[model samples]
Target: IDAMLEGFEVSKENFSTNFNGELLIITITLLSFLGLYYSAEKLTSRTSLTVSSKPLAIGLMIAIGIGLHNLGEGLAIGAAIGLGQVALSTFLIVGFALHNTTEGIAIASPLAKTKSPISKIIILGLIAGSPAIFGTWIGGFFYSPYTAIVFLSIGAGAIFQVALIILKWLYQSEQKLVQASIVSGVGVGMLIMYLTSILV
Candidate 1:
Protein backbone atom coordinates (compact mmCIF):
# COMPACT_ATOMS: atom_id res chain seq x y z
CA ILE A 1 0.00 0.00 0.00
CA ASP A 2 2.77 2.40 0.93
CA ALA A 3 4.74 1.35 -2.10
CA MET A 4 1.81 2.03 -4.39
CA LEU A 5 1.23 5.41 -2.82
CA GLU A 6 4.89 6.26 -3.16
CA GLY A 7 4.84 5.20 -6.78
CA PHE A 8 1.86 7.41 -7.53
CA GLU A 9 3.42 10.30 -5.67
CA VAL A 10 6.58 9.92 -7.69
CA SER A 11 4.60 9.73 -10.90
CA LYS A 12 2.74 12.85 -10.00
CA GLU A 13 6.00 14.64 -9.35
CA ASN A 14 8.04 13.33 -12.26
CA PHE A 15 5.72 12.05 -14.97
CA SER A 16 2.99 14.65 -14.89
CA THR A 17 4.15 15.92 -18.25
CA ASN A 18 3.41 12.54 -19.83
CA PHE A 19 0.01 11.49 -18.60
CA ASN A 20 -0.59 8.89 -21.30
CA GLY A 21 2.76 7.27 -20.69
CA GLU A 22 2.14 7.21 -16.99
CA LEU A 23 -1.27 5.61 -17.48
CA LEU A 24 0.19 3.00 -19.79
CA ILE A 25 2.89 2.10 -17.28
CA ILE A 26 0.36 1.72 -14.49
CA THR A 27 -1.94 -0.38 -16.63
CA ILE A 28 0.84 -2.72 -17.70
CA THR A 29 2.06 -3.08 -14.14
CA LEU A 30 -1.38 -3.97 -12.82
CA LEU A 31 -2.01 -6.49 -15.58
CA SER A 32 1.39 -8.04 -15.04
CA PHE A 33 0.68 -8.48 -11.36
CA LEU A 34 -2.59 -10.25 -12.08
CA GLY A 35 -0.86 -12.52 -14.55
CA LEU A 36 1.95 -13.32 -12.13
CA TYR A 37 -0.43 -14.20 -9.33
CA TYR A 38 -2.46 -16.54 -11.49
CA SER A 39 0.64 -18.14 -12.90
CA ALA A 40 2.00 -18.77 -9.45
CA GLU A 41 -1.25 -20.28 -8.36
CA LYS A 42 -1.29 -22.60 -11.35
CA LEU A 43 2.33 -23.61 -10.87
CA THR A 44 1.82 -24.39 -7.21
CA SER A 45 -1.16 -26.52 -7.98
CA ARG A 46 0.62 -28.55 -10.65
CA THR A 47 4.00 -28.99 -8.97
CA SER A 48 4.73 -31.84 -6.63
CA LEU A 49 6.81 -31.23 -3.53
CA THR A 50 7.84 -33.23 -0.49
CA VAL A 51 6.17 -30.66 1.75
CA SER A 52 2.71 -29.22 1.41
CA SER A 53 2.51 -27.04 -1.64
CA LYS A 54 0.27 -24.28 -0.35
CA PRO A 55 2.42 -23.28 2.58
CA LEU A 56 5.59 -23.34 0.52
CA ALA A 57 3.90 -21.32 -2.18
CA ILE A 58 2.74 -18.79 0.36
CA GLY A 59 6.23 -18.41 1.75
CA LEU A 60 7.73 -18.09 -1.71
CA MET A 61 5.22 -15.46 -2.74
CA ILE A 62 5.79 -13.54 0.46
CA ALA A 63 9.53 -13.62 -0.18
CA ILE A 64 9.06 -12.38 -3.71
CA GLY A 65 6.80 -9.57 -2.53
CA ILE A 66 9.24 -8.51 0.15
CA GLY A 67 12.07 -8.74 -2.35
CA LEU A 68 10.28 -6.30 -4.63
CA HIS A 69 9.72 -3.92 -1.72
CA ASN A 70 13.36 -4.21 -0.70
CA LEU A 71 14.39 -3.47 -4.25
CA GLY A 72 12.68 -0.11 -3.96
CA GLU A 73 14.39 0.46 -0.65
CA GLY A 74 17.72 -0.32 -2.25
CA LEU A 75 16.99 2.12 -5.05
CA ALA A 76 16.42 4.81 -2.49
CA ILE A 77 19.69 3.97 -0.77
CA GLY A 78 21.65 4.02 -3.98
CA ALA A 79 19.95 7.19 -5.17
CA ALA A 80 20.85 8.94 -1.93
CA ILE A 81 24.44 7.84 -2.25
CA GLY A 82 24.61 8.66 -5.93
CA LEU A 83 23.44 12.19 -5.19
CA GLY A 84 26.12 12.50 -2.47
CA GLN A 85 23.72 12.45 0.44
CA VAL A 86 25.99 10.23 2.46
CA ALA A 87 24.22 10.77 5.76
CA LEU A 88 20.82 10.05 4.28
CA SER A 89 22.11 6.97 2.51
CA THR A 90 23.69 5.62 5.67
CA PHE A 91 20.53 6.26 7.65
CA LEU A 92 18.43 4.51 5.01
CA ILE A 93 20.74 1.54 5.01
CA VAL A 94 20.44 1.12 8.76
CA GLY A 95 16.73 1.80 8.87
CA PHE A 96 15.97 -0.57 6.00
CA ALA A 97 18.10 -3.26 7.59
CA LEU A 98 16.14 -2.98 10.80
CA HIS A 99 12.82 -2.80 8.95
CA ASN A 100 13.60 -5.85 6.84
CA THR A 101 14.27 -8.06 9.83
CA THR A 102 10.56 -8.53 10.37
CA GLU A 103 10.20 -9.74 6.80
CA GLY A 104 11.99 -12.95 7.73
CA ILE A 105 9.17 -13.76 10.11
CA ALA A 106 6.63 -13.13 7.34
CA ILE A 107 8.43 -15.58 5.10
CA ALA A 108 8.86 -18.17 7.81
CA SER A 109 5.42 -18.14 9.36
CA PRO A 110 3.67 -20.16 6.67
CA LEU A 111 6.42 -22.74 6.53
CA ALA A 112 6.56 -23.24 10.28
CA LYS A 113 4.58 -26.49 10.13
CA THR A 114 6.34 -27.78 7.05
CA LYS A 115 9.47 -29.91 6.93
CA SER A 116 11.21 -27.56 4.56
CA PRO A 117 14.97 -27.85 4.43
CA ILE A 118 17.41 -25.22 5.64
CA SER A 119 18.81 -25.06 2.14
CA LYS A 120 15.39 -24.18 0.78
CA ILE A 121 14.96 -21.55 3.43
CA ILE A 122 18.30 -20.05 2.48
CA ILE A 123 17.23 -19.95 -1.15
CA LEU A 124 14.06 -18.14 -0.20
CA GLY A 125 16.06 -15.62 1.79
CA LEU A 126 18.27 -15.08 -1.20
CA ILE A 127 15.25 -14.66 -3.43
CA ALA A 128 13.91 -12.06 -1.06
CA GLY A 129 17.16 -10.16 -0.53
CA SER A 130 19.21 -10.44 -3.71
CA PRO A 131 17.11 -8.04 -5.79
CA ALA A 132 18.28 -5.17 -3.60
CA ILE A 133 21.75 -5.55 -5.07
CA PHE A 134 20.49 -5.20 -8.60
CA GLY A 135 18.25 -2.34 -7.55
CA THR A 136 21.19 -0.55 -5.99
CA TRP A 137 23.22 -0.87 -9.14
CA ILE A 138 20.37 0.39 -11.30
CA GLY A 139 19.57 3.28 -9.01
CA GLY A 140 23.20 4.30 -8.75
CA PHE A 141 23.78 4.19 -12.47
CA PHE A 142 20.42 4.85 -14.13
CA TYR A 143 18.29 6.32 -11.31
CA SER A 144 15.09 6.83 -13.26
CA PRO A 145 11.95 7.81 -11.42
CA TYR A 146 9.92 5.94 -14.02
CA THR A 147 11.67 2.70 -13.18
CA ALA A 148 11.11 3.26 -9.49
CA ILE A 149 7.41 3.77 -10.07
CA VAL A 150 7.08 0.50 -11.93
CA PHE A 151 8.99 -1.48 -9.32
CA LEU A 152 7.06 0.06 -6.45
CA SER A 153 3.74 -0.60 -8.12
CA ILE A 154 4.63 -4.21 -8.80
CA GLY A 155 5.78 -4.66 -5.21
CA ALA A 156 2.57 -3.19 -3.89
CA GLY A 157 0.47 -5.45 -6.07
CA ALA A 158 2.39 -8.53 -5.06
CA ILE A 159 1.98 -7.71 -1.38
CA PHE A 160 -1.73 -7.09 -1.87
CA GLN A 161 -2.15 -10.47 -3.53
CA VAL A 162 -0.25 -12.16 -0.73
CA ALA A 163 -2.50 -10.54 1.83
CA LEU A 164 -5.53 -11.87 0.00
CA ILE A 165 -4.07 -15.36 -0.09
CA ILE A 166 -3.35 -15.29 3.63
CA LEU A 167 -6.80 -14.06 4.41
CA LYS A 168 -8.35 -16.80 2.30
CA TRP A 169 -6.23 -19.38 4.06
CA LEU A 170 -7.28 -18.05 7.42
CA TYR A 171 -10.92 -18.11 6.47
CA GLN A 172 -10.67 -21.65 5.20
CA SER A 173 -8.75 -22.83 8.25
CA GLU A 174 -11.09 -21.38 10.86
CA GLN A 175 -14.29 -21.71 8.80
CA LYS A 176 -15.10 -18.20 9.92
CA LEU A 177 -14.68 -14.71 8.47
CA VAL A 178 -13.02 -13.08 11.43
CA GLN A 179 -11.27 -14.09 14.64
CA ALA A 180 -10.17 -12.28 17.77
CA SER A 181 -6.56 -13.39 17.47
CA ILE A 182 -6.44 -12.16 13.89
CA VAL A 183 -7.74 -8.76 14.87
CA SER A 184 -5.36 -8.40 17.78
CA GLY A 185 -2.40 -9.58 15.74
CA VAL A 186 -3.19 -7.18 12.91
CA GLY A 187 -3.61 -4.28 15.33
CA VAL A 188 -0.34 -5.02 17.05
CA GLY A 189 1.46 -5.46 13.78
CA MET A 190 0.20 -2.12 12.48
CA LEU A 191 1.14 -0.43 15.73
CA ILE A 192 4.63 -1.89 15.58
CA MET A 193 5.04 -0.83 11.96
CA TYR A 194 3.89 2.68 12.77
CA LEU A 195 6.42 2.98 15.56
CA THR A 196 9.14 1.59 13.37
CA SER A 197 8.24 3.95 10.56
CA ILE A 198 8.73 6.87 12.90
CA LEU A 199 12.26 5.71 13.58
CA VAL A 200 12.93 5.08 9.92
Candidate 2:
Protein backbone atom coordinates (compact mmCIF):
# COMPACT_ATOMS: atom_id res chain seq x y z
CA ILE A 1 0.00 0.00 0.00
CA ASP A 2 2.87 2.40 0.75
CA ALA A 3 4.49 1.62 -2.59
CA MET A 4 1.22 2.29 -4.41
CA LEU A 5 0.83 5.60 -2.58
CA GLU A 6 4.36 6.63 -3.55
CA GLY A 7 3.60 5.85 -7.19
CA PHE A 8 0.47 7.94 -7.04
CA GLU A 9 2.36 10.91 -5.63
CA VAL A 10 4.98 10.59 -8.35
CA SER A 11 2.26 10.56 -10.98
CA LYS A 12 0.72 13.68 -9.54
CA GLU A 13 4.02 15.53 -9.62
CA ASN A 14 4.61 14.51 -13.23
CA PHE A 15 1.15 15.61 -14.15
CA SER A 16 1.70 19.01 -12.62
CA THR A 17 4.97 19.43 -14.47
CA ASN A 18 3.37 18.48 -17.77
CA PHE A 19 0.55 20.88 -17.21
CA ASN A 20 2.92 23.72 -16.47
CA GLY A 21 5.02 22.93 -19.53
CA GLU A 22 2.01 22.85 -21.84
CA LEU A 23 0.72 26.12 -20.50
CA LEU A 24 4.10 27.72 -20.95
CA ILE A 25 4.43 26.51 -24.53
CA ILE A 26 0.97 27.68 -25.55
CA THR A 27 1.44 31.03 -23.88
CA ILE A 28 4.73 31.59 -25.67
CA THR A 29 3.35 30.41 -29.03
CA LEU A 30 0.43 32.75 -28.69
CA LEU A 31 2.74 35.60 -27.76
CA SER A 32 4.81 35.04 -30.90
CA PHE A 33 1.73 35.63 -33.03
CA LEU A 34 0.81 38.58 -30.85
CA GLY A 35 4.08 40.37 -31.58
CA LEU A 36 3.50 40.13 -35.33
CA TYR A 37 0.01 41.49 -34.85
CA TYR A 38 1.32 44.73 -33.34
CA SER A 39 4.14 44.88 -35.80
CA ALA A 40 1.49 44.88 -38.51
CA GLU A 41 -0.08 47.87 -36.80
CA LYS A 42 3.16 49.78 -36.95
CA LEU A 43 3.71 48.89 -40.60
CA THR A 44 0.18 49.67 -41.79
CA SER A 45 0.15 53.26 -40.52
CA ARG A 46 3.11 54.16 -42.69
CA THR A 47 0.96 53.60 -45.77
CA SER A 48 -1.48 56.29 -44.72
CA LEU A 49 0.59 59.45 -45.16
CA THR A 50 -0.37 60.29 -48.76
CA VAL A 51 -4.07 59.62 -48.49
CA SER A 52 -6.69 62.16 -49.56
CA SER A 53 -9.54 63.23 -47.22
CA LYS A 54 -11.58 60.06 -47.48
CA PRO A 55 -8.58 57.78 -47.35
CA LEU A 56 -7.22 59.72 -44.39
CA ALA A 57 -10.39 58.88 -42.46
CA ILE A 58 -9.84 55.26 -43.30
CA GLY A 59 -6.24 55.63 -42.29
CA LEU A 60 -7.17 57.09 -38.94
CA MET A 61 -9.62 54.28 -38.39
CA ILE A 62 -7.00 51.71 -39.26
CA ALA A 63 -4.49 53.36 -36.96
CA ILE A 64 -6.89 53.47 -34.05
CA GLY A 65 -7.94 49.89 -34.59
CA ILE A 66 -4.33 48.75 -34.93
CA GLY A 67 -3.32 50.58 -31.76
CA LEU A 68 -5.98 48.78 -29.78
CA HIS A 69 -4.83 45.55 -31.36
CA ASN A 70 -1.29 46.28 -30.28
CA LEU A 71 -2.39 46.76 -26.71
CA GLY A 72 -3.85 43.30 -26.89
CA GLU A 73 -0.44 42.02 -28.02
CA GLY A 74 1.26 43.63 -25.06
CA LEU A 75 -1.15 41.83 -22.80
CA ALA A 76 -0.43 38.50 -24.45
CA ILE A 77 3.31 38.95 -24.01
CA GLY A 78 2.87 39.80 -20.38
CA ALA A 79 0.61 36.84 -19.85
CA ALA A 80 3.01 34.41 -21.54
CA ILE A 81 6.01 35.35 -19.45
CA GLY A 82 3.91 35.37 -16.33
CA LEU A 83 3.30 31.67 -16.99
CA GLY A 84 7.08 30.96 -17.12
CA GLN A 85 7.71 30.24 -20.80
CA VAL A 86 10.70 32.55 -21.00
CA ALA A 87 12.56 30.73 -23.77
CA LEU A 88 9.63 30.54 -26.16
CA SER A 89 8.77 34.09 -25.23
CA THR A 90 12.28 35.18 -26.15
CA PHE A 91 12.01 33.43 -29.47
CA LEU A 92 8.89 35.48 -30.14
CA ILE A 93 10.75 38.69 -29.34
CA VAL A 94 13.61 37.90 -31.68
CA GLY A 95 11.40 36.79 -34.55
CA PHE A 96 9.18 39.86 -34.23
CA ALA A 97 12.16 42.20 -34.19
CA LEU A 98 13.32 40.74 -37.48
CA HIS A 99 9.82 40.68 -38.93
CA ASN A 100 9.03 44.27 -38.02
CA THR A 101 12.08 45.56 -39.84
CA THR A 102 10.77 44.13 -43.09
CA GLU A 103 7.32 45.39 -42.28
CA GLY A 104 8.61 48.91 -41.76
CA ILE A 105 10.20 48.88 -45.16
CA ALA A 106 7.13 47.48 -46.85
CA ILE A 107 4.83 50.04 -45.31
CA ALA A 108 7.12 52.93 -46.18
CA SER A 109 7.54 51.96 -49.81
CA PRO A 110 4.26 53.41 -51.09
CA LEU A 111 4.69 56.57 -49.05
CA ALA A 112 8.14 57.01 -50.49
CA LYS A 113 6.63 57.41 -53.95
CA THR A 114 4.61 60.45 -52.82
CA LYS A 115 7.57 62.63 -51.81
CA SER A 116 6.33 62.92 -48.23
CA PRO A 117 8.59 64.58 -45.68
CA ILE A 118 11.14 62.32 -44.06
CA SER A 119 10.05 63.53 -40.65
CA LYS A 120 6.46 62.49 -41.33
CA ILE A 121 7.59 59.08 -42.49
CA ILE A 122 9.85 58.63 -39.50
CA ILE A 123 7.15 59.73 -37.08
CA LEU A 124 4.63 57.33 -38.57
CA GLY A 125 7.14 54.50 -38.58
CA LEU A 126 8.05 55.06 -34.96
CA ILE A 127 4.41 55.33 -34.02
CA ALA A 128 3.71 51.98 -35.59
CA GLY A 129 6.91 50.16 -34.62
CA SER A 130 7.56 51.20 -31.02
CA PRO A 131 4.79 49.06 -29.53
CA ALA A 132 6.81 45.92 -30.11
CA ILE A 133 9.14 46.95 -27.33
CA PHE A 134 6.26 47.34 -24.91
CA GLY A 135 4.64 44.10 -26.01
CA THR A 136 7.91 42.21 -25.61
CA TRP A 137 8.36 43.38 -22.05
CA ILE A 138 4.79 42.40 -21.24
CA GLY A 139 5.19 38.89 -22.69
CA GLY A 140 8.39 38.50 -20.72
CA PHE A 141 6.67 39.31 -17.45
CA PHE A 142 2.99 38.25 -17.35
CA TYR A 143 2.37 34.86 -19.18
CA SER A 144 -1.38 33.87 -19.07
CA PRO A 145 -3.42 31.86 -21.60
CA TYR A 146 -6.72 33.66 -21.19
CA THR A 147 -5.03 37.01 -21.61
CA ALA A 148 -3.14 35.76 -24.63
CA ILE A 149 -6.28 34.56 -26.45
CA VAL A 150 -8.16 37.75 -25.77
CA PHE A 151 -5.37 39.77 -27.34
CA LEU A 152 -4.99 37.30 -30.20
CA SER A 153 -8.61 37.69 -31.22
CA ILE A 154 -8.42 41.47 -31.03
CA GLY A 155 -5.23 41.60 -33.06
CA ALA A 156 -6.62 39.28 -35.70
CA GLY A 157 -9.72 41.41 -35.96
CA ALA A 158 -7.71 44.58 -36.32
CA ILE A 159 -5.64 43.14 -39.15
CA PHE A 160 -8.76 42.07 -40.98
CA GLN A 161 -10.13 45.56 -40.50
CA VAL A 162 -7.05 47.13 -42.04
CA ALA A 163 -7.23 44.74 -44.94
CA LEU A 164 -10.59 46.29 -45.71
CA ILE A 165 -9.00 49.72 -45.74
CA ILE A 166 -6.52 48.47 -48.27
CA LEU A 167 -9.33 47.15 -50.37
CA LYS A 168 -11.12 50.48 -50.28
CA TRP A 169 -7.98 52.36 -51.23
CA LEU A 170 -7.30 50.06 -54.13
CA TYR A 171 -10.80 50.00 -55.54
CA GLN A 172 -11.13 51.68 -58.95
CA SER A 173 -7.51 52.74 -59.10
CA GLU A 174 -4.44 52.14 -61.21
CA GLN A 175 -2.62 51.20 -58.01
CA LYS A 176 -4.80 48.22 -57.23
CA LEU A 177 -1.98 45.77 -57.75
CA VAL A 178 0.31 47.76 -55.49
CA GLN A 179 -2.33 47.78 -52.80
CA ALA A 180 -2.85 44.07 -53.20
CA SER A 181 0.87 43.52 -52.91
CA ILE A 182 0.97 45.44 -49.65
CA VAL A 183 -1.84 43.32 -48.26
CA SER A 184 0.00 40.17 -49.29
CA GLY A 185 3.18 41.50 -47.74
CA VAL A 186 1.46 41.69 -44.40
CA GLY A 187 0.38 38.08 -44.83
CA VAL A 188 3.96 37.21 -45.60
CA GLY A 189 4.90 38.31 -42.12
CA MET A 190 2.32 35.92 -40.72
CA LEU A 191 3.54 33.10 -42.95
CA ILE A 192 7.14 33.63 -41.96
CA MET A 193 6.31 33.26 -38.30
CA TYR A 194 4.27 30.14 -38.94
CA LEU A 195 7.17 28.60 -40.85
CA THR A 196 9.61 29.50 -38.09
CA SER A 197 7.49 27.58 -35.62
CA ILE A 198 7.91 24.50 -37.80
CA LEU A 199 11.67 24.92 -37.51
CA VAL A 200 11.33 24.99 -33.76
Candidate 3:
Protein backbone atom coordinates (compact mmCIF):
# COMPACT_ATOMS: atom_id res chain seq x y z
CA ILE A 1 0.00 0.00 0.00
CA ASP A 2 2.75 2.39 0.98
CA ALA A 3 4.81 1.53 -2.06
CA MET A 4 1.84 2.07 -4.34
CA LEU A 5 1.13 5.37 -2.65
CA GLU A 6 4.72 6.42 -3.11
CA GLY A 7 4.50 5.60 -6.77
CA PHE A 8 1.28 7.60 -7.00
CA GLU A 9 2.95 10.53 -5.32
CA VAL A 10 5.77 10.36 -7.81
CA SER A 11 3.32 10.17 -10.66
CA LYS A 12 1.56 13.29 -9.46
CA GLU A 13 4.66 15.37 -10.00
CA ASN A 14 4.63 14.52 -13.70
CA PHE A 15 0.88 14.44 -14.17
CA SER A 16 0.79 16.65 -17.20
CA THR A 17 2.82 14.36 -19.43
CA ASN A 18 3.89 11.09 -17.84
CA PHE A 19 1.08 10.20 -15.51
CA ASN A 20 -0.95 8.15 -18.02
CA GLY A 21 2.12 6.39 -19.31
CA GLU A 22 3.25 5.64 -15.78
CA LEU A 23 -0.11 4.12 -14.96
CA LEU A 24 0.14 1.91 -18.03
CA ILE A 25 3.63 0.88 -17.04
CA ILE A 26 2.55 0.09 -13.51
CA THR A 27 -0.44 -1.92 -14.65
CA ILE A 28 1.58 -3.92 -17.14
CA THR A 29 4.38 -4.59 -14.70
CA LEU A 30 1.94 -5.68 -12.03
CA LEU A 31 0.08 -8.05 -14.36
CA SER A 32 3.33 -9.46 -15.70
CA PHE A 33 4.44 -10.36 -12.19
CA LEU A 34 1.13 -11.97 -11.39
CA GLY A 35 1.24 -14.00 -14.57
CA LEU A 36 4.76 -15.16 -13.89
CA TYR A 37 3.95 -16.08 -10.31
CA TYR A 38 0.97 -18.18 -11.32
CA SER A 39 2.92 -19.84 -14.07
CA ALA A 40 5.67 -20.75 -11.68
CA GLU A 41 3.19 -22.01 -9.16
CA LYS A 42 1.56 -24.23 -11.74
CA LEU A 43 4.88 -25.60 -12.93
CA THR A 44 6.00 -26.41 -9.40
CA SER A 45 2.74 -28.13 -8.57
CA ARG A 46 3.16 -30.59 -11.43
CA THR A 47 6.48 -31.87 -10.14
CA SER A 48 6.53 -34.78 -7.77
CA LEU A 49 7.86 -34.14 -4.28
CA THR A 50 8.51 -36.04 -1.10
CA VAL A 51 6.98 -33.40 1.13
CA SER A 52 3.95 -31.19 0.83
CA SER A 53 4.82 -28.43 -1.60
CA LYS A 54 2.12 -25.91 -0.79
CA PRO A 55 3.83 -24.44 2.24
CA LEU A 56 7.16 -24.30 0.48
CA ALA A 57 5.53 -22.63 -2.47
CA ILE A 58 3.82 -20.10 -0.25
CA GLY A 59 7.08 -19.35 1.51
CA LEU A 60 8.82 -18.82 -1.78
CA MET A 61 6.09 -16.47 -3.00
CA ILE A 62 6.24 -14.48 0.21
CA ALA A 63 9.99 -14.25 -0.08
CA ILE A 64 9.73 -13.00 -3.64
CA GLY A 65 7.19 -10.35 -2.68
CA ILE A 66 9.18 -9.22 0.31
CA GLY A 67 12.32 -9.15 -1.81
CA LEU A 68 10.68 -6.83 -4.31
CA HIS A 69 9.55 -4.53 -1.53
CA ASN A 70 13.00 -4.55 0.06
CA LEU A 71 14.56 -3.71 -3.27
CA GLY A 72 12.51 -0.50 -3.28
CA GLU A 73 13.66 0.13 0.26
CA GLY A 74 17.25 -0.40 -0.79
CA LEU A 75 16.78 2.11 -3.56
CA ALA A 76 15.66 4.64 -1.02
CA ILE A 77 18.72 3.92 1.09
CA GLY A 78 21.06 4.17 -1.83
CA ALA A 79 19.40 7.32 -3.15
CA ALA A 80 19.75 8.93 0.25
CA ILE A 81 23.42 8.05 0.42
CA GLY A 82 24.05 9.03 -3.17
CA LEU A 83 22.52 12.44 -2.53
CA GLY A 84 24.72 12.79 0.59
CA GLN A 85 21.90 12.62 3.03
CA VAL A 86 23.98 10.62 5.42
CA ALA A 87 21.65 11.09 8.38
CA LEU A 88 18.63 10.10 6.31
CA SER A 89 20.44 7.10 4.91
CA THR A 90 21.43 5.96 8.36
CA PHE A 91 17.92 6.42 9.61
CA LEU A 92 16.48 4.42 6.69
CA ILE A 93 18.98 1.66 7.28
CA VAL A 94 18.11 1.36 10.94
CA GLY A 95 14.40 1.55 10.34
CA PHE A 96 14.52 -0.98 7.53
CA ALA A 97 16.57 -3.36 9.63
CA LEU A 98 14.10 -3.17 12.47
CA HIS A 99 11.15 -3.64 10.13
CA ASN A 100 12.80 -6.50 8.28
CA THR A 101 13.28 -8.48 11.45
CA THR A 102 9.63 -9.42 11.19
CA GLU A 103 9.99 -10.45 7.57
CA GLY A 104 11.96 -13.42 8.83
CA ILE A 105 8.87 -14.56 10.64
CA ALA A 106 6.71 -13.95 7.56
CA ILE A 107 9.02 -16.10 5.49
CA ALA A 108 9.36 -18.80 8.09
CA SER A 109 5.81 -19.24 9.30
CA PRO A 110 4.60 -21.29 6.35
CA LEU A 111 7.63 -23.54 6.46
CA ALA A 112 7.41 -24.16 10.19
CA LYS A 113 5.60 -27.47 9.87
CA THR A 114 7.66 -28.65 7.00
CA LYS A 115 11.05 -30.30 7.30
CA SER A 116 12.68 -27.89 4.91
CA PRO A 117 16.44 -28.01 5.34
CA ILE A 118 18.60 -25.25 6.72
CA SER A 119 20.07 -24.74 3.28
CA LYS A 120 16.64 -24.21 1.77
CA ILE A 121 15.80 -21.74 4.51
CA ILE A 122 19.04 -19.89 3.85
CA ILE A 123 18.24 -19.71 0.15
CA LEU A 124 14.80 -18.30 0.89
CA GLY A 125 16.35 -15.73 3.18
CA LEU A 126 18.70 -14.69 0.42
CA ILE A 127 15.85 -14.52 -2.07
CA ALA A 128 14.05 -12.17 0.27
CA GLY A 129 17.10 -10.01 1.03
CA SER A 130 19.80 -9.99 -1.64
CA PRO A 131 17.86 -7.72 -4.01
CA ALA A 132 18.46 -4.86 -1.62
CA ILE A 133 22.12 -4.98 -2.63
CA PHE A 134 21.28 -4.69 -6.31
CA GLY A 135 18.70 -2.02 -5.64
CA THR A 136 21.10 0.02 -3.59
CA TRP A 137 23.65 -0.15 -6.37
CA ILE A 138 21.12 0.98 -8.95
CA GLY A 139 19.75 3.75 -6.80
CA GLY A 140 23.21 5.02 -5.97
CA PHE A 141 24.53 4.96 -9.48
CA PHE A 142 21.48 5.47 -11.67
CA TYR A 143 18.79 6.89 -9.50
CA SER A 144 15.78 8.07 -11.47
CA PRO A 145 12.30 8.82 -10.25
CA TYR A 146 10.87 6.96 -13.19
CA THR A 147 12.89 3.87 -12.41
CA ALA A 148 11.93 4.07 -8.75
CA ILE A 149 8.30 4.28 -9.69
CA VAL A 150 8.51 1.13 -11.72
CA PHE A 151 10.28 -0.83 -9.01
CA LEU A 152 8.00 0.45 -6.30
CA SER A 153 4.98 -0.43 -8.36
CA ILE A 154 6.35 -3.87 -8.97
CA GLY A 155 6.88 -4.33 -5.27
CA ALA A 156 3.38 -3.20 -4.53
CA GLY A 157 1.94 -5.65 -7.02
CA ALA A 158 3.97 -8.56 -5.71
CA ILE A 159 2.99 -7.81 -2.14
CA PHE A 160 -0.63 -7.55 -3.11
CA GLN A 161 -0.46 -10.94 -4.76
CA VAL A 162 1.17 -12.42 -1.70
CA ALA A 163 -1.56 -11.00 0.50
CA LEU A 164 -4.24 -12.53 -1.69
CA ILE A 165 -2.52 -15.88 -1.64
CA ILE A 166 -2.27 -15.80 2.14
CA LEU A 167 -5.86 -14.86 2.52
CA LYS A 168 -6.93 -17.68 0.24
CA TRP A 169 -4.79 -20.10 2.19
CA LEU A 170 -6.22 -18.87 5.43
CA TYR A 171 -9.73 -19.25 4.17
CA GLN A 172 -9.03 -22.81 3.13
CA SER A 173 -7.38 -23.65 6.45
CA GLU A 174 -9.94 -22.18 8.76
CA GLN A 175 -13.52 -23.20 9.44
CA LYS A 176 -14.50 -19.60 9.88
CA LEU A 177 -12.95 -17.09 7.52
CA VAL A 178 -13.13 -14.23 9.96
CA GLN A 179 -12.04 -15.73 13.22
CA ALA A 180 -11.27 -13.53 16.23
CA SER A 181 -7.77 -14.89 16.53
CA ILE A 182 -7.02 -14.01 12.92
CA VAL A 183 -8.44 -10.55 13.30
CA SER A 184 -6.51 -9.94 16.49
CA GLY A 185 -3.36 -11.28 14.94
CA VAL A 186 -3.69 -8.89 12.03
CA GLY A 187 -4.48 -6.01 14.36
CA VAL A 188 -1.47 -6.72 16.51
CA GLY A 189 0.77 -6.95 13.47
CA MET A 190 -0.52 -3.64 12.17
CA LEU A 191 -0.03 -2.02 15.56
CA ILE A 192 3.51 -3.28 15.72
CA MET A 193 4.23 -1.97 12.23
CA TYR A 194 2.75 1.40 13.12
CA LEU A 195 4.87 1.64 16.22
CA THR A 196 7.98 0.72 14.28
CA SER A 197 7.20 3.36 11.65
CA ILE A 198 6.95 5.91 14.48
CA LEU A 199 10.46 4.95 15.45
CA VAL A 200 11.56 5.48 11.89
The best candidate by lDDT is: 3
| lDDT (10s digit) by residue, model 1, range 73-145 | 7887788888998988877777777776767777887788888898988999998889888888888888988
TM-scores of all predicted structures = 0.84, 0.54, 0.85
Q: What is the model-wide C-alpha lDDT for candidate 2?
A: 0.51
The worst-scoring run of ten residues by lDDT in candidate 1 lies at 169-178
Please report, in order, the local distance difference test score of every candidate based on alpha carbons: 0.74, 0.51, 0.78
Which candidate, 1 or 3, has the higher TM-score? 3
Candidate 3 clash pair list: none
Counting clashing residue pairs in each candidate, in order, gives 0, 15, 0
| Candidate 2 ranges with C-alpha deviation above 4 Å | 1-66, 137-146, 176-193, 197-200
Per-residue lDDT of 44 in model 2? 48
Prediction RMSDs, each to the true structure: 2.6, 11.4, 2.5
Tens digit of per-residue lDDT, candidate 3, span 58-140: 77878888898889889988988999999988888888887778777778877788888989889999999999889999999
Model 2: lowest-lDDT 10 consecutive positions: 1-10
